[model samples]
Target: MKKTIFTIACILSLNIFNSCSEDIIDLKPPYEEIIEDAIKSEEDVNKFLMGTYLKISSTSLYGSNFFFYGDLLGDTFFRSNKNFGGYTSLIMMNYDPINTGDINFYRSAYDVIQNANFVINNELTDSQLNKQYKAEARFLRAITYFNLLNYYAASPKSGLNQDIGVPIAVYPYNPDEKIARSSISDVYKLIVEDLNYAIENAKAETTSKIYITKTAAKLMLSRVYLTRQQNGDAQLAYNLTDDIINNSPSSFKLFTSTTKDAFKNYFSSSEDIVAENQPETIWELDMNVLNNPGVNSSLSVFYSRTGSKRGLLAKQTFYDSFGTSDVRRDLFSFTSIPVEDNPKGVWMAKHERAAQPGGNYTRNNKILRFSEAYLNRVEALYQLGKNTEALTNLNEFASLRNGSAYSGGNLLNDILSERNKEFFGEGQRFLDLKRYNLPINKGTNCPGNCDVPAGSKYFVFPFSEGQLIINPLAVQHPLW
Candidate 1:
């Protein structure tokens, strides 16, 4: 819980990595002075926990790239006319393992994980508040590990626990030591352990969209189970969502209104989007002028039409897939803006900024929401062979979106298609594709060279070249 960044120079020789890649250090505010025995009391533990939240909201971890890559790396997006070669590697369908962007994500996420471990191991205070704080820290740790697994390891359909996963750190880090990658099965064991502890100990007072709570913990656990998709996992996931939906109505109810735009209203800038009014939000990151992720890395800088890069634009085919009456299509930009040699402006209006200065960068991030939980349950119920129940849930959600209801057909494809429409520009498509073992079918909007085969190694990103050289114990993923 110290305010100091845990310098990992002893873990990896910084000289091995080029100047472009920062050597994966866990950084806290250098302006603050270090305090010894800092986390011994409740106040100190609270400050430390605030730092953990900051790490989760960091640009490298969840602020920008994580959200963008969640879709860009999978499909349904293309390097737009705004492509200045920034994310060309991602669009090409073969990532440069040593690219600066990849390195930044890998390092930033691990840094956050290490901080959580530090809190879980320490926090000697026996006070009730401290216990809840430590439990929240553990929940953050579980979420970080889960995201890392999504990027660094193969899906359960591919190898389950047999594939290599990122290192699992459960104690305070010592720079002199280095740890090897754990097996995916081994990594998940710790993840489940942490979440179980969090669910039992997390306090009700800490329940909010910006922080971890029992509901968020349950939702994350259901997501983990859904991804694994084992024999009984679908049933387990369905039950977890059903429990949350049936109870916790005051905390996790979907937004409702008499207005026509109720379904798409939340994405726009409004007072209703706040945690208090937006009970539908399970977790989010607060972003403002003072606490923004800087100019280039700002959340709006990639998706909004005002962004310098404007990285994400719906393909023509994808745009047509949406029903004419569906209001979600209003998020895309149809206006034509010129690019150097590429096509004109095919941008997203969903993430646009306010007209005022600095408003472009000032956007709160929604990490998890109740709508996603609702969709998760639908798929799980379908997988459990409860088609009637699945369709009922699907119809409720679709009607809310003003989209057509599901007729009798392939339940699996119907569930996935519903997810695609509901979660467009929300960074859920890529992982869903992976979960379904679907191919990367690019529309006319994507890069020309991007046509990835199903189950390609490209789907699994590799460690930075510097990581392989610096950490001898760390093994490079195949075909890196």
Candidate 2:
């Protein structure tokens, strides 16, 4: 079965490469050539699916772009002085209305979405194969749309439904055709629907926690419901995810021995990972520095200082947020080694991997974890007025970092702070800020009045001008 699947995957990959290249260049081939040669068998279909997975390695999405844009562009982090050009301009509030970085992110997200749609719409028809592959594709599509919507459109309640989101292109593209921006509601609706289908139809045996599985679908649904303020649905989704964690064959345990072990083991190793169908992880980007050079290069960009060139560093605020007792502070941040041209300064945690004497650094980009599931359950319980249950779960996680148990305050606030500390530099701060409706500290470095009070606009990024050009129907987000 594995060999058959592998062979099919290769054929499908070749087909996708030829098809995508032809579409980009506007090659006019006969209709029969296009349809008949598209995909041949179940094996071909599997290969096309692999191609979609391959695109995640691109710099813009799961690769370096995810690390840099998600962390550097937000507060609580900054570019290292050695590697501080466009990044300083970004974090220091120097982005213009037409920033090229924003444009690159926009195009990259669309590229991933397009590949997912191709698999969903064109490949996999056998009932067994269709069920498995479709679920994976749907999960990928939903994740891509979620990222794009968060970056390029307003939050759901911003009344920007009429505003164009990134184009929802869901098929083989015809270069000559014009696409319009989809409404935020429509886009979200599609995302939810896709996730629901994936949850119901995806094969449990073929799934793993690291890859998209039924639990991942539930987790994503919870997230979407929370974003839309659908409390009941959110609670339902969270409950479902929690049940998976509590009852799954794989156990989700926090590192109770020490903070350093918690950070290092959780992020850098697979000890905490729940396999495909288990509970600890719902979905994770499959990244390894050994076979996948793209993920390796991207992470290297963040930590590399080959002379005076540094990439990004931890912010002073982030360092200050932790108390003297918090060991995560030391584990996540580091001082630079003195090299001939590179002066020493504080660098962000190279926790993902240790520097190799002459070999490349390698680590998986963990997109989700069992810890997140525990947090989700706690938050949902709190929102549902089950404060006691929420606190119980909250303290359980906190106790893992240190031997001391948590004495909780405001349930929501405790959850937020816990997330901030646990997930710092993991590309989750901005989402936390948006979800809690907290104002981002524009601070002294903001280009205009740093004092502009935060609200919905602060949470939503504006659509790129280039995207608007291609899809004129897309409208600028309000209060941009």
Candidate 3:
């Protein structure tokens, strides 16, 4: 279980892409440290693992763009005219290999994966704590890989191109080595493997939502299975969620209060929950006053009315889709301040302002939550032909949120629509659309070019030209 840590011989060369006209902004590499035998004990592994978590929370990954693109590319939000020209490529669905944000995401994700690989490959100590640290590292790597695959590779169900996926790194990064894109099937294989290992060896959910736990691993793996939809995968996903809802510890269940204040307080709470509270977040990135991603990349910056760079506004159509009785609708409110084109607009209130001087609007990035368990299970049940069970679960979840009861007709669509209402700003829609092979329809909010055809190659983002040049074996996505 021990291995020699090798020194990095060369600095990885990355093309620093920047074009203000194209709305591209440069980002720093996540890690510049040399790997050594520094990680020789459980404490060392713990420290490095924490670094990996910090890297994964970068704006290019989960903290901002990763989640924002999910809603931006989907139908939830549009680029407001009062806005400057930042992130225009994402909203317009026109990006190439040289786009800085895309490149940043690709590189940052790999950087995190490399760190996780370092932890996983080396036996820092033969202690039980070391085993848990490795498990946590594997969980981080799996989630990173899964997110990479979502953008870099076509969905397994997309039927467009499924052969090429992002490169899989299981060992410490070596700059001199050129890596090729693994097959999509192979990439998912490694993700599932890592997650399964974490589920077996990682600690259970306790008082922390910031750390990955067995419940988080199980929830993530269920999502993976739900996405793949291979033989018996729906059943597998359903079983995992069922166990979570019924058998997991009380610290990992939903916030099932039906009151408006309860729903509002849940999203706007600036602090992590203690043991006595009903758990909503299964995994979240810790964002505090001391450690905050400043305005430009902060998730709250886009949604908070006080945010100087507030450019993502809710579409009137989407805003109206909420039922009158639904407490979730209260999450959106009018902003009188005129953006570029619009005189006033509605903004999502899910991310509370950690409002600091100098526009450092910040909030914890909620990555996974318990409500998804119901959504995933409901969809899986419908997919498994258990319509009665699916409706029962769906109604239970909806009633808790004060949404009108859904009786019948087109149950799958109902499930998806419910997900849209429940997770509008949380970055779930884009992939949900892809998995279901649905078109991206912007309705009245379309900026000239509205519909991205079902199974379009645009769904599969292109590999950076720099990556293709550096790793000769690396292939650009087809039709990019």
Candidate 4:
């Protein structure tokens, strides 16, 4: 299986190289033909990793949709009246499996998996650089697998480990061959296996946080375990996040200050978030003027008040949920005068680009951040029955954000609400709602289909019809 996979990977990689050289001028292809010669030195391996990283950041997947998909699916973001340009189907729960090209995240993810497999299956371990390259590939493969499962399958918490996840494609790409989807638990096991290897060995020393590291892998591990919600998984989550929190104290502090402009600075200055100056940023997808998701697909187009679409907005009730003293609420701004004879309830300005419409979208897509590690730990501790410890961590983080500390109440509800506030526009609420299998009580404010009531099929997205046609054994999601 390994030999067959490796041989096919070479072909797939050559095709990837050819597409770049022949069509895309901006991405310079690596020198003269064939696998071994092009990959003779360490420089060759670095080039492949960088190319794969760019591919993963494509707008279809992480570059844009995946982030907001989290918001649109959850209670946080929904289409405002008269604004139906972006994610209307998702917010309205109207997915069409037949509209294959636009909605599917399959190809982009599999492309990365294939590219990463090329690096992994090769005997790239003769030198230190080669081993590091292998580790980097492992990290990317793990990250892709994690997201794939999130979209295609139900969480164990929701489905008791019996849901179908996307196919395991880590071996290699073969157009003739088809691998059936694995159970959610099985896919998670592979994700953990790859991430564990990365946790122990991947340094990612030369690359910026854009590349995954021990800390990033640990954060991912913490999430996976927390979602599983088993006794052992919860403990693992606690241990993993505790190490990241305690060991890297200064390296991962939250943005806090005396003035109300505390969290504002993190988003107000585009440089702070995208340039890696903010301490909270663990791993962020780099976007710049020269290289970015084209203006039409840029993430900025959705969140900015004056963005291209600005289809979604923070609900007034959601806005009122925040305390007056909370610095986080300042991240939003409503058009009180009414753009189309109707005012929108403050689109999230958390993604301000300073020079947005004129410049290419330089808004960095944050993959993992330090603040999440705190939330992950608090959730784990709370689940472990260590309410005191969980509340302490929660209060500490809340205090830093200018919110009142918990004197003593329902920690879980408080934590959930805080997640809604802190991660607004960063995309998190959806999965939590799915994992808990709770109705998306969009309250009285939502304009359409707000109630994602119990046992909703919209919880998981449809596999594209093109995918179903190609892979005969694959099943379409029930909702579609």
lDDT of 4: 0.70
**Residue-wise lDDT of candidate 2 within 1-480, one digit each (tens)?**
111111122122223332222222232333223432555655545555566666665656776566666565456555544444455434644454476463366765666666566567653455866667778788888888988877776665444543566677735555545677787778888998998888887655333343566656766777777666553766775676677666643434333446565455545443324222233344555444332444235565465443223555555555666666665655554545323223233455533443434444435555666667777777778767888988998888776665234567666767877876777666777776665556566442233424323464545566567766776666666656
Q: Across residues 227-331, which tens digit of lDDT does each residue of candidate 1 receive? A: 877778898888778877887647677754424355445666644343233777777776665556776777577777667665566666667776776667666
List the candidate 4 regions with Cα displacement exceeding 4 Å. Answer: 1-38, 82-84, 99-102, 160-163, 204-207, 272-275, 335-343, 356-358, 407-409, 444-447, 478-480
Q: Where does model 1 exceed 4 Å of error?
A: 1-36, 83-85, 98-103, 205-208, 258-262, 270-277, 336-346, 355-359
| TM-score top scorer | 3
- Name the runs in model 3 displaced over 4 angstroms: 1-36, 98-103, 270-278, 337-345, 356-359
How far is 439's C-alpha from truth in model 4 (Å)? 1.9
Q: What is the lDDT of residue 388 in candidate 3?
A: 93
How far off is residue 468 in model 4, in Å? Answer: 0.7
TM-score-wise, the better of 1 and 3 is 3
Question: lDDT (CA) for every model shown?
Answer: 0.68, 0.58, 0.76, 0.70
Give every collision pair in model 2: 8-43, 9-47, 82-310, 83-310, 207-276, 208-276, 208-277, 209-275, 209-276
lDDT of 4 by residue, 355-378 (tens): 744574746777788888889998
TM-score of each: 0.87, 0.79, 0.89, 0.88
lDDT measured at residue 446 in model 3 versus the true structure, 0 to 100: 59
